[model samples]
Target: MDIHGTIKIDELKKPYFVWFEENWIHDDVLHHHQKGQLVYVESGFQYITIEEKIYLLPQNHAVWIPPNAVHKTNSHSEKIKLMIMFADISTQESFYYEVNVFSVPPVLKEMIKYAEKWSKQMTVNHNENLFLKALFNELPQFVEHSLTLHISLPKDKRLAKVIQHLHNHYRNEIKMEDLSDTAHLSFRTLERIFKKETGLTLSKYQQMLRIIKSLEYLSSGNLTISETAYEVGYKSVQAYTRSFQSVMQFRPTDFIKTIQ
Candidate 1:
């Protein structure tokens, strides 16, 4: 998927820089940089893989990549618009040390949009740099809006088989003993390895995967809320809504409004 052979910018040496990319299409190879990156999807979506986990960045959301974090990304939508900011963070707070995906608040969204006008390396005392500093300082407060949308793939070969099976049958009922048999491990051993590798229990991981897949289904506009709930394996709309709210921190109707 080399729609663009390479989109290059000298971001590593610059203290701060901004790049506005429209309809970006690249399946980037695994790479890392010394600068922290903030990629906001103005429209469409992008998928980022970090530490064997896949994170979906939908419209009106952003993903923060800490300096030196190993990852790769790809976006399929021709309508995609991205505002990417790179900053040197040697003296920054500890908050910038982690990877996160969160909904872009209205204020931060506007700030990022406004930042599109300046597309080159910024000097320390430049007016744009001051605004960028302010944006970074206020980001910790917004981290509370982080979403639980990442899907983890275990490194263990046997556990990975179970994860693949879960993804293929997420819309149907699953049994633990069945997964254990498929993994060729005892039930307790299978669960233990899975939890250790993914940091989530099997049930919790399944619930999260269902909710993440439902986002794509809901955004496609062919399914109503109740239909989407049932499509993702929920027995009732109320149960689905509860799970959605727990993971996304918003109701399904509210999310629909943002995309529409």
Candidate 2:
């Protein structure tokens, strides 16, 4: 797929910067990225959906998306933000997805502005890298608003095990018995608890996840419909097509072509 590529401004020796001043959500955006991304709202508000979790970011906060993850963006038409995308993660690898409500410290603020300037100027001096490194070191996360996953997301042991297993293997038929094993409960008990916790049936959640992955693939435009179906673990194209159509109101090929 011809990606309506993010307006990237990366220097070979410096950071990649993006500054969206206004309703970037209305502008064309394709898939997410292959490198870590830091999205900080300098002004106005924006809503982001990542890994089935949602975050509403206002000024003074930022959200991070690890490489290759499925993410969606929502912006108020007046929203203005500057995003810094990089191949490098300044914090520990484990902290990559843990970013939320990061208080933009004085140092981090200017560094971001310098990067934005460079994004427009198309150049950065050697000393810029040192300042950039220092800024990322202590970008404080806001304590007041509670850096939360919007939907009271639980760390249910049952859900955790089921997720890992499906992630490792979503190609097989989604069997209630198998899911029950992951949850260490009888199928009936597991279903009841899963529904209560996530507000979605086990089957529905699994389907949603598959569809999200499928859309990411569709963004590439390179995968044939059959290839994408199997890639996301659908055993057959017809079954995958049905699911995609039911959820997204479009077949894979048609979606790709429409986006292209």
Candidate 3:
């Protein structure tokens, strides 16, 4: 089953890796890995497709893809990632729905390799784990990026409010009427704004919402395809898979496989 999906994590080492691009390895076809990944592209750019969204991560940037996400790594320049794999399974849920990036500081750039060595020894103790945990917490949240991506919706003020609410709550499935009442706009006006601002109808946006949520979930090994699909309001995995493929242009399983 390729359960481990790892190299150098055999008997002698704990689940951790400091892979220079040349040291990277892959697994058998059709297997998905559930492990925390911290990728740092020190020189060039790389596009990591997770759940079908292509994130062009450039130099000085790092991405954290939680376990089990269907993702792949390809470099426009040399890419080096210091990845940590945790089989304990608890770290999977710590950040389950979204991918985050942080700017690497000078110390972290050095610490990434140092920590991996310390972890392998099995002797540095919990204090080392604690330090990593705190550093993870201090990692940057791209507030500017978030604000830039979020633009104000169309002019129907009430309608705008409701649509904004729904968009932000993409993880949860919302009904049309609830949205209408919340915005104090007629369903017709809200529908128009949904189309105008997002380039998709309200119903379409809702579907996109579920897809995105599922995308994040599918990438984070914390949720299985079936579990996350249903949780995001799909009635059947087959239906979710079809729609997922239509939008993402990549098979979920295949996407996960190539990432190693």
Top model number, lDDT: 1
Cα distance off (Å), candidate 2, residue 246: 38
Model 3 error, position 59 (Å): 15
- The best candidate by TM-score is 1
Query: What ranking emerges by TM-score with the best candidate at the front?
Result: 1, 2, 3
What stretches of model 2 exceed 4 Å from their correct place? 1-15, 18-30, 75-79, 83-87, 90-92, 120-125, 140-146, 152-260
lDDT of 2: 0.58
Evaluate all candidate structures by whole-model CA lDDT and list the values in order: 0.79, 0.58, 0.53
Residue 219, candidate 1: C-alpha displacement in angstroms:
3.7
User: Per-residue lDDT tens digits of candidate 3, residues 142-212?
Assistant: 21121011122355455656666765776565677678778677888767765776566776666666665
In model 2, what lDDT does residue 116 have?
68
The C-alpha stretches of model 1 lying farther than 4 A from their native spots are 1-12, 74-78, 120-125, 220-222, 257-260
> Per-residue lDDT of 1-260 in model 2, one digit per residue for the tens?
11225344232444543443443443334355555667766655565666666555545456666765666664442545545435455455455555454445555666677666444334555665565555554443322232432432335765788766665666557676778876779988987887887776777767766775665455444577889899888889999999988865667776555333
Clashes of 1: 0
TM-score, per-candidate, Cα-based:
0.87, 0.48, 0.41
Worst 10 residues of 3 by lDDT: 142-151
Ranking by lDDT: 1, 2, 3
